[model samples]
Target: MTLTGVTVQGRLNLSQQHLAHGLLFRDCHFDDGVDLRGAVCEELIQFVGCELNDLHADNIIARKGFSVVDCQLRRVSFASAQITEDLRLSKSRLSHEVDHVALHGPNMVIEKSLRLDETWITGEVRIPFSHVGQDLDLRSAHLDNGAGLALDATSVIVGGQLRGDDGFTARGEIRLCWGRMSSISFRAAELHKPGGVALRADSIHVSLGCYLDQGLTASGTVRLVGAQIDGELACTASTFTSASGAAIEAERLVAKDVYLDRGFRADGVVRLVGAQLARQLTCTGGHFENPAGDALDLTGITCTGSVYLNQDPQHEQCFHAHGRVQMCGASIGESLVCSSGLFEFPGGVALDADGLNAVGDVRLNQGFRAVGRVRLSRATIGRQLDCGASSFVSTENPALDLTGLVGHGDVLLTSGFRAAGQVRMRDADVSRDVDLSTAHLEGTGTKVFDAFGLRVGGTFTFQLAQPPKAEVDVRFADVRRLNDSPSSWPTRQTSMEGLTYQSVSNIPCSGRIEILQGTKAFSLQPYRQLGKVYREASKTKEEREVLIAGLRDYRNRGKLKWPQRMWNLFLEHTVGYGYRLWRPFVIALALVVLNFPIYHTAEHHNLMESVGAKESQEHHNVKHCPTDFPCFNPLAYSIQLFIPVSNLHEVDKWVPDATRGWWSTFLLGWTWLMIIIGWLLAAALGAGLSQAVRRQ
Candidate 1:
C-alpha cells in the first residue's frame, strides 16, 4: 500500500478491501471521492500520477488488474464492478464540473480486456449491462458528451472486439444499442451527432467484421436496425452526412458483405430496407447525394453477391447515385453492376429495381446514365439483361419500365443503347435475344417499344437501331425472328398490329410499295409476316411477290379509284389471287379466240344457223330453212358467246341487221362480253374445284 506524496482528505474508504499487497497511489491527491463501496480488491489497483477527485467504484471487486495510468479523474464510477484482469484506463483524463457521468459502467464485469487508450472523457460514457471479457478497446478515445451520449453501450457484451477504432472521437451519440459484439472496429471513428444517431447499433449482434473503415466521419444516423452481422459491414473510406433522415439505416440487416464502397460518401438516405446480404454489395466508389429523397434504398435487399454500383474502370471510380436508387423487391445473387453509373432521379424513380430477381445478370451496361424511371417491372432475370451502352432518360412515365420482365437470358438494349421515354416491355418473358442492335429508342410519350405481351425467344433485334422516334407498338408480341428493315421499322413509325413475328431478317423486297407505306388497310397479318420472310429466304419469286401483294391489298379494301385500282389489278392477275383454277380456264380459252375475231368483224346477220343443219340444207339451198335464217358462221357465233352451256343451235342465230347499224352495237357488245367470260369461267372453276377437294 504505497501512497506516495499523499494528500487524501475525506471519503477514502475501500469498504471491503482484502488487498493482499497491491494498492499503489503515486503523487496522490484525492480531495473527495475514493469510496470503492464494498470493495474487495485482492491485488493490483494502482492509480499512478493520480489526482482522483472522484472514482466511486460501486460494488467494486477488482481481483487482479485496474490501473488509471496517467489519471486525472473528476468522476468515474465503475458501478457493480468486478474486474478480474485487464481494465486499464491508459493515459486517462476524465472531467466532471458537476459529475455528468464520466465513465459510469453499469453491471461491469470486465474479466480480461477493456482499455481506453489515450483516454480523455468529458462526460457520459455509461457502458450498460457491461460484460467485456476481451476487447472493448477505445483506441485514442476522447469522448466529449456535449450534445449527449458520447458512448452508451446499451447491452454491452463484447467478448472479442468492439474497438472504437484507432483515432476514435465522439462528441455525442455513439450508443451501441443492444450491443453484443465480436468485431466492430470503427477504423477512423469520429462520429458526430447532428440530427441524432451517429452510430446506434440497433439489435446489434456482430460475430465478426463491422469496420466503419478509413477515416470514418459520420454526421448522424448510422443506425443498424436489427443488425445481425456475421462478417463484413464495412463503410470503407466513409464520410456519411445525414441531413434529416437515414444516412445508412440498415433496416433488417443480416450481413456478410456490405461495404458502402471505396470512397463512400452519403448525404442522406442510404437505407437498406430488408437487408440480407450474404455477399458482395460493393458500391465501387459510392457518392450518394440525396436530391430530395431515396438515394440508395435497397427495398427488400437480398444480395448474395455482386451489387457493385460499378464505375470502377480501375478506380475511375464513380457511383454518383444522386437520388432514388431503390431496389424494389431486390434479390440479386450475382450481377447488379451499375456500370459507369450516374442514375439521377429527376422527377423520381431513377433505378427502381421493381420486383427485381436477378440470379446473375442485370448490369446497367457501359456508360449507364439513367435520368429517371428505370423501373424493371416484375423483374425476374436469371441471366443476361445488359443494357449495353445505357442512357435512359424519362420524360414522364415509362422511361424503361420492363413490365413483367422475365429474362432467362439475353435482353440487352444493344450497342449504343439510349432510351428517352416509353420502353415499357408489357408482359415480357425474354428467354433469349432482344438485342436492340444499336438502340436509340425514344417515344416521349405514346409508344416507342411498348411491347405488349412480349415474349421473345430469339432474334427480335431492331438491326442497327437509329430510327425510333416513336410508334413501335408490338401489340401481342410473340417474337421469334425480326431483325428489322424497311429502314429499320418506319411503317408510319411502326405498329405491328398484333406482333407475331416468325422470321424477317432484312425485308426490303425491292421497295414493295415502300414497305407497304402506312398500311391503313390490307393487314393480312403483315403480309403474312412478310410472306414468312420470303418463305424463309428461299424467295419463291419473293414469296409470290409478297403473297400477291397481300391479295391485291385485301381485294382493294375501299375507295379504289385509278380505274378501280386497275380493275383490282386485272382481277388479281386473272384471278389466281382469288382461286386460280388454271387462271379462269386460261381466260376462258383466250375469250374463245378473242370472240372469234369480234364475230368475224361484226357480221350483219346470223346469230347461229348451220353447223350441220340438214347438211347445211344442201349447201345453203335454203329448202325448209330459207324462211327462217341463213349462215354467217363467225365460228358459229363465237361458239354462242364463249359457251355458257353451249349445245347452241349456233346461239339462236344472232342478227346485226339494218345496214350494220354499227353492226348492231358491235354484235351487242360481243354477246355481252362473251356472257361475262362464261360466268367468270364457271366461278373460277368452282373455286378451284373446292380447293382441290379440300386438299384431298
Candidate 2:
C-alpha cells in the first residue's frame, strides 16, 4: 500500500510486513516519537511528499529497503537501522536535534546506491561496517556535528568524505573524488589502488582552534586533483606509507603554510604539479620512494616559502622532491633542502624553478647529493645561496645544471663541482655528455658559479667556464683565467682552473707553454677555439707569463705545478724557525759592521770582558772587597794573571800591574760592548728590511 501524509504514532509495527510497497509519511505530525523498529519493508519508504513533525524512530529496522529521498524528517532517528536495497537520502535537511544525528546504519547492507549528496545533516552520522553494493556518493553534503561522524566500512564503494567534528576513521576504500573535511582524521587507512582520494575542494580546512591535539592523517594514497588550501595544515605525527600509488598527489594544491613534521613515506610518485604555496611548507622527515616507479615526482610546483625535506638514516633516497619547483619569479621567502646522502630536486631552481623565483634565502645542507643536473635556467632571484657541504653527482648526468640562474647576491657552490661546471662527461661516467659548450657568462657585474672542491669521475672540463676564474672552478676548458688579475668582485672569491683539455685523448698540446710569477700554463689550441665561441678576450702578457712559468716548473718536477711557479716552487711559501734563530746574531753583526771602528778594536773586547766579569761576580764580593784584592781574594792571583795576559799580545812587557793593565783592559771591553750593541741593532734592522721586501 502507498500511504501518504498520515501519522502512525503507537505500535506501527511493520516487522511482519515483508515486501511492502511504497509507504509515504507526507505532512504528518506525531505527538510522541514513532517506532518502526525491526520493521521489514521491501519497497521505498518515502517522507518526500510530506512535512513530518516529531518522528522518532530509533532502531528503525528495515529488512529489505528504505528510501528517504528528498524527505523532511522533523525529528527522526535511525540509530541502528538495517536496510537491504538502496538508501537514498539526497537533498534532505534534518536540522535542530538533541543528539544531532542523521543516519545510523551500523551493520546494514544496501545492494543499490546510497546517495547523500547536497544534504544538510545538522547532527551525527554513524555508518560503520555498512555494506553498499554499488556507489556510495556523499558529494557536497554538509554535516555540522556537535560531536563528530564515524563511518568506517569494509565493503563499500564510498565516493565522498565521511566528514564530521570529532574525527572520521574509515579503513575501507574512501574515494574522495571532491571532498572537504574539518577536524577529521583517517590515520593508517589503506587506499593505494587507482582512482583513490582526490582533493578538488578549493580550500579544505582542518582547523581545530583550541583542539590542536588532533591531526588529519592519511597513511594511504591521498591524491589531490587540483586542490587549493588557504590555511595552515599540520601533518604532525602523521604517516603516509605508500609504496606504489601516490602517497599524496597534490596536482595543483595552493596552500599558505603546510608543515609535515612527523614524516611522509611514498613508495610511488608524489607529484605536486603547478601548485603555488605562499608561506613555509616544511617536509621535516618525509620519505619518498618508487621501487616500481619514480619516487617523488613534484613536476611543477611554485612555493613562495621554504621547503625542507630532511631524511633519517634508515631511508636513503627516501627524501626526494622531483619535477620543476620554481621560486625564481615568485616571491619565495626562504628555501632549505637539508638532509644526508642524496636529496634531489632536479630541474628546479635553487630559489626559483621554471621562471618562478624567490626574493629570500636558499640553503642546501651538507651531504646533499643531486644525481641529475639542477637546472635553474632563466630563473631570476634575490637571495644568498649556500651549497657549501653539498655534492652534485653527475655520474648519471651533468653535475651542476645551473643553466639559467639569475642570482642577485651570492651563489656558493663551495662543495665539489666536477667537470667545468658544464657538460661533465668524457673520461667521466656522467649519465649523458653535457653541452655548456655555448653559454654567456657576464663578468661585468654578476657573481657566477663557485665550485670549490669538485671531483670528477674521469677527465673534467670547463669549456663554458668564464673569466674572474676566482669565482668559478671549471675542470674542463683551460687554466687561462689564472693570468687575469684576481677578481675585484664584491663577493669573496677563488681562482678557476679550467681542466678541459688536460685529459683529452689522442690530441696532445705540441706548442711550448710558458708561465710567469708561479702561474700554471694551459693548452692554447683547444682553449683558443673554445674562447672564440665564448667571445673570450685574447691571452694577455700576464697570462702568458703565468703559463710559461708553470710549464717550466712542470718540466722540472715531471708534474703540473699547483698554485706555485718556478721561483719558490721547491720551498714552502711560509717562513720557518731556522731563519728565526740566526736573526738576532745577524742584527748584532750588522750593527758592528755599520760601526767598523768599534767592531775591530781590542779595547772593545777588554771593555766587554770587564763588564761581563763585574755582572757575574757575587754582590757581596763586589761591595766588600779587601784593599789588596778590591774584590774577592779567592781569585786575586788569577785576576792578576789575567790582567797581565789581557795585554799578552804585547809580550815584551810581561809584568802584572793592577792599575795600568786593568784600566786598559776595561777600556777595551767597554768599546767592544758598544760595538757589539751597534752590530746587533744593524743586524736586526737589516733582517727586518729583508723580510719586509720578501713579503712585499
Candidate 3:
C-alpha cells in the first residue's frame, strides 16, 4: 500500500496487527505516535519524507526491511524489535531535544544492517545491548548532543564491520565501550568533545582489526584502554591534538600489531604504558610533539616482534618526538632499530630505556644524532649494539651512558662514532668483541671511555682515530685479547693499571713494556697479569721470559739510580733474563778471568802451596817444602776459588797465610762472592732449561 499525503488522527494503533502487503508513506503524518507494538509486518515498511511525532515499535516484527529516507522524526523506539532485512535511515533527521535519548533501541536485533547515511541526530542515539548481524554503518552521519554523548552503543555486538567513516562528525563523545565486533573503522572521521573524551571504546574485543586511520581527527582524548584486538589496531594518517591530556591513551591494550604511521601526528601524550602487543608497535613517519612532557611513554611493554620507532625504509620516515620517549623495562623480541634518524630531546635525554631486554641487535647507527644524553643503562641485548656513525653531544656529562649494559654479540663503537661527553659502560659484559677502532671520543671530565670492570670474550680493539688524542681509562677490564700495537698503544694518556687480559701473546714485547710503563711504578701486578695469561695458555717459557723481562725493565728504567741499573744488568747478562741456558757459563768464565790476579798472590806464602805440595815439610818424615815446584799457576788457583761445586785444582792444599793479612783477606772475600753467584746462576739456568723442555 502506497499512501501519499495522509494523516492519522489520535494514534495509528497497529498493535497486534498483521500486515500482509508492503506499506509506503509519502508526505504522511501521524498525530500521536505510530504504534507498531506487537505488530508483524510481512514485507517492506518504508516512510519516504514522512513526519512522525513518536514511533513506538516495541516487540514489532518486520520480515523484509524498513527505511525512512529523507524523513523527520521527533522521537523513536525499537525495543525488542526484530528486523529480518536492512534498517536504513538515509538523509533523515532525528531530534528529541526535550527527551533524554533521541532514538533508543536497547534490545533490537537486525539480521542484515543498520545504516544511517547522511542522517542528522540531535540527541543521544543509543543502541545498548543490541545485535546487528551484518553491519552498523553510519557513514556521513552528523550527531550533536550539546554536552552529552552523541552515540552510546555500549555492550553491543556486531557480526560484521562497524564503521562511522567518511565525514562522520560527533560533537560529543562517541562511546562504544566494552563492545564486541568483527572490526571498527572510522576513516576521515572528526570527533570533538570539549572537556571530555572524544572516543571511548575501552575493552572493545575486535576479531579482525580496528582502524582509525586516514585523516581521522580528534580534539579530545581518544582512549581504547584494555581493548583486545586480534588483528592490527592501526591509526595511519590520523591527526590527534589534545592539549590538555593524552591524545591516545591505550594502556594495557592487547593487539596483534599496533601502527600509528604515515603522517600520524599526536600533539599530546600517547600513553601506551603496560600494553602487551604480539607484534610491532610501529610509528614511522609519525610526529609526536609534547615538548613540555613525555610524548610517548611505553613503560613495561612486552612485544613479541620489534618495537620499531625507526622501521621506515623511505627517507625522512622518522618518528619525531620533541619531548621524552621513555620505555622503561621494555622487553622486545627483536631489535630496537633507530638507525639513520634524528631524535632530538633538547634539554633532557631523548631515549631512556633502562632494563631493556632485547633478543636481537639494538642498532642506532648511520647518521643518528642526539643533542641530549641517551642512557640505556642495565640493558641486556642479545645481539650487538651497533652505534657506528652516530653522534651524541652533551658537554656536561656522559652523552651515551650505557652503564652495566651487556651485549652478547659484538659492540661496534667504531667507524667514526663520536661522543662529546663520556661514554660510560662500567661493569658491562660483552660476550663478543667491543671494537672502538677509528672512533672519536672526547671526555669532558676524567676519561672518555669509563669501561671499568668490563669483560669481553673476544679481542677489544682500541685502534684510535686519525689525529688521536682520546684518553681512555679501562681500569679493570677482563678481555681475551687486545688488538693494540706498541706505537699506537697510547695516543694520549690511557690508564690500564689493573686492566686484565688473557696472557700477553701475539703483542710485541715493546708494547707489553709500554703498557707496564703506563703504571709508572714498580708494582709486580702487571707482570703477574701478563704471566698468568701465558701460563694458562701453556706457554711456560714465555711466562718466565715475561716475568724476568718485567723485572729487568723495572730495575733498569731511566728513573732508577745507577746501583739499580747495575743490579739489573748483572741479572740480565748472568741469567739471560732467566731463560738462557748458556748465559751462566759465559758469566762464570768472565768472573774467573776477572778474579785471576786476586788469588795469584796467595801462592807466595803458605797460602801459596802448589798442587801436591805439602804445607809442612821436615825432611821426608821431617818434611821439607818441595823446593822446585812447578811454577805456581794463578789461572789454576783462580779456577779453584771460582768453581765452588768442582774440585778443579789443588787450591785447598794452600792455606790462607795471616802473615800477609790483606792478601789473605782478599782471597777469602773472593771465595765468598764466588759461592753466592755460583748457586744463584746455576739455579736460574736449571729452571730455564727445565721449563723449555717441558713446554716442548
Instruction: Score each candidate by Cα lDDT.
Output: 0.79, 0.43, 0.79
CA shift of 154, model 2, Å: 20
Order the numbered candidates by lDDT, best leading. 3, 1, 2
Comparing 1 and 3 on TM-score, the stronger one: 3
The worst-scoring run of ten residues by lDDT in candidate 1 lies at 615-624
What is candidate 1's lDDT per residue for 339-372, written digit by digit as tens? 8889898888888888989898988889989898
TM-score of each: 0.48, 0.41, 0.78
Quick one: how many clashes does candidate 2 have?
A: 72
RMSD of each: 13.9, 20.0, 5.6
> By the lDDT metric, which is better: model 1 or model 2?
1
- Count residue pairs with overlapping backbones in model 1: 5
The per-candidate count of clashes, in order, stands at 5, 72, 10
Report the C-alpha lDDT of model 3 over 1-696, residue by residue, as the tens digit. 999999888888888899999999898988886888888999998998888888888888999988888988887788888999988888888877822688888888999998888999888888888899999988999988876888889998999999889899888888889899999998999888856789999999999999899999988889999999999998998998886889999999999899888789898889888899998988877788888888888888889998777636765676677777888899999988777656667768877888999999888888777767788899999999998988887765678888999889989987899888778888989999888878877655666777888889998887757433455667788898878645434444565657888644477654676667664335566677887787888877767777777777677544778876775676667665556667878877888888676655454444543335555643221123456443446677566654667764445544444455776677666666776777777766766666557645
Candidate 2 structure lDDT: 0.43
